[model samples]
Target: MKKFLQKYSEFMRGRYGVDDLFYFLMISTLILGLFPNFLLKNGLGLIRWLLFGFGIFRYLSKNFTARSKENAWFMKVFRPVKKEIKFLYTRIRNIKTYRYRRCPKCHQQLRLPVRKGKHTVVCPSCRHEFEVNIRF
Candidate 1:
C-alpha cells in the first residue's frame, strides 16, 4: 500500500489534481444522478457521464496554467452565489430569533430581534427613523 501510494503521488506530481470547477462538475453530476429515471427518459443520461468525464479530464490534465485560470474564473463567478446561499441558510436557521429588514432610506439590510407589534426603528447607516410591524 505504501509503495502504491508513493507511485501514485509521483505520477500525479505535475498533473492538476482537483479544483473548484472540478468539484462543481462532480457535485452537479451527483445531483443529476439523483434523477436517473428523468434523465434517461429525456435522453439526457449521458450528461452526467460527460460531466464526470470532463471533471476527470480536468483533474488529470497537465496544463496547470489553464486549469488554474478556469478555477479562478469559477471562484470569481461563484463567490457571490455562495455568499447568498450561506446568508439564506443562516437566516433560516435563526428565523425564530432574528428578523431581517431593509432600511427604506439607505436600503441597507438590518437584523432586528423578533418582536411583535408596531415599533419605531432607526437605520444605523442613514440614521433614518421608520416604523416596522412584526407580525410573527
Candidate 2:
C-alpha cells in the first residue's frame, strides 16, 4: 500500500506540477457541481464554472500542442460572463491588488480595494472609521 501510494504520488508529480494540480482541482470542483453545497452558496456556481472552464483552457494550453496565440484567441472568443468571471479571476490571481488596512479607531483589519485615491472606509468587524489612501 505504501509503495503504491508513493508510486502514485510520483506519477502525479511527473504528469502534473503545482499549476496543473490547481487547474485539475478547480475543474473537478466544478465538474462535481457541489460548490453550492459548500464553497459557494450564493448562486456563484456560474462564476465557478466559468473559472473552471478558463482553467481547462489554461491547462490545455500548457500540456497540449497548441500555440499561445490560439489559446488566447479561444479565451477571447469565449469570454465567459464577459465581466463577472474576469473580475473574479483577476481578483483571485492578483495578490498585489488586495491590501490589508487597519482601522485607526478600532485597529480592525479591513480589506481595502487597491488603487490610487483616498476614500472613507468602514470596518464591518469593529465598526471602525478610517480613511484609506490607496496608491497604485
Candidate 3:
C-alpha cells in the first residue's frame, strides 16, 4: 500500500492537478448522466468519460505554462459569474435586512438597508448615481 501510494505521488509530481473547472465539469457530467432519456444518458456517459480523460491528461501534462494559462483564462471568464451567484445567494439569504439594486450605468450590484423612502444611491465602483425606491 505504501509503495503504491509513493509511486502515485511520484507520478503526480509537476502535474497540473485539479482545479475548479474540473469540479464543475465533473458535477455537470454527474447530473447529466442521470437524465431519463436514453440518448441523453448515453451522451452524458460519453461526456463523462471525455471529461475524466481530459482531467487525467491535464494531471499528467508536462507543459506547465500552457496548463497554467488555460486555467487562468478559464478563471478570468468564470470569476464574475461566480461572484454574482454568491452575491445573489447572500442577498436572498438576507432579503429582509437589505435591498439589492443594480447601477444603471455599469450594472454593478448595490446593496442598501431596508428603508421606507426613495433615496439616491451611488455606485462605489463607477460612481454612478441613481434613485431607488425602497419598499416592502
Which candidate achieves the best TM-score against the true structure?
A: 1
Instruction: For candidate 3, write residues 1-136 as lDDT tens digits.
Output: 9999999999888887777766766676677666638646455456667876776777678888887887888899999999989988998999999998889999987789999799998899999888999978
> Which of candidates 1 and 2 reaches a greater lDDT?
1
Candidate 3 collision pairs:
none
Per-prediction TM-score, please?
A: 0.90, 0.29, 0.71
Which runs in model 1 stand beyond 4 Å of their true positions?
A: none
Model 3 worst lDDT window (10 residues): 36-45
Candidates in order: C-alpha RMSD to true structure: 1.5, 13.0, 3.4
Candidate 2 has a TM-score of 0.29
Off by over 4 Å in 2: 1-94
Candidate 1, residues 71-125: lDDT per residue as tens digits? Answer: 9998999999999999999899999999889999899999999999998999988
Clashes of 1: 0
Task: For model 2, state the Cα shift of residue 19 in Å.
Answer: 29
lDDT of 2 by residue, 1-136 (tens): 9999998776555232335334444867656575476546566666666767666555544354344455466556555655667766766786586866668777765767677788888789777767788876
Give the lDDT ranking, best first.
1, 3, 2
Q: What is the C-alpha lDDT of each candidate?
A: 0.94, 0.63, 0.81
The candidate maximizing lDDT is 1
Indicate the worst ten consecutive residues by lDDT in candidate 1.
14-23
